[model samples]
Target: MGQFTPESLAASGQAFELTTAGGCGVFVAEVHGERLWIHGAGAVGSKNLTQDGLALFEAMALAGGCRFIRFETDRPGLVRLSKKAGFKTRAFVMEKEIKKC
Candidate 1:
């Protein structure tokens, strides 16, 4: 992921795994107040990207004491699926890369 690496996640103890219909995959969790942030790897063949698998990740977040779960993504398919899964768009994140000057 552009925002996180395996090394960073492993070092921070924020990495978690889920068992999907296809296989298994990983997710990263960050808790803020009662809210939890998590997302599954979207890369194909990475496994656990299915809906049931992702739901397991959400369940983990809630079980970990988070009342809300949030994740950032730019994928249209994922966005649609999330909406079907009852996730509402709370905010939009915009970014501009600042090149070396």
Candidate 2:
């Protein structure tokens, strides 16, 4: 697992941490117009990671004062968890690396 520094999020003023009885999660979010965009998240590997992540999403949404929340993930587990948390997949993202000339 990677290190979780809540200080980093607090200093940026664009992120927050959410802790529940199950576990804890760190998320970076920003309010864009009418939406709360969750840039990324990280948490310890545990059976309750999904639940913790969902809780974090809700907290971020409420704090951002946005009705819509958006985030992207490539991890299959997270995809499933997000769906279970009532988030629908809107689009798929693809990327390619450019070779230096």
Q: In order, how many clashes per candidate?
A: 0, 0
Give the lowest summed-lDDT range of ten residues in model 1.
39-48
Candidate 2 lDDT, 1-101, residue by residue in tens: 45646665555447766666666777787777877777657766575867676766677678768788887788898888778888898998999987999
Q: lDDT (CA) for every model shown?
A: 0.70, 0.73
| Candidate 1 per-residue lDDT over residues 20-74, each given as its tens digit | 4566666667778888877445444432365765586578777989888888888
lDDT of 1: 0.70
lDDT, candidate 2, at 40? 57
Cα deviation at 51, candidate 1, in Å, is 0.8
Best prediction by TM-score = 1
Alpha carbon lDDT at 44, candidate 1: 41
| Candidate 2 positional error at 90, Å | 0.9
TM-score of 2: 0.71
**What is residue 26's positional error in candidate 1, in angstroms?**
1.2
Off by over 4 Å in 2: 1-13
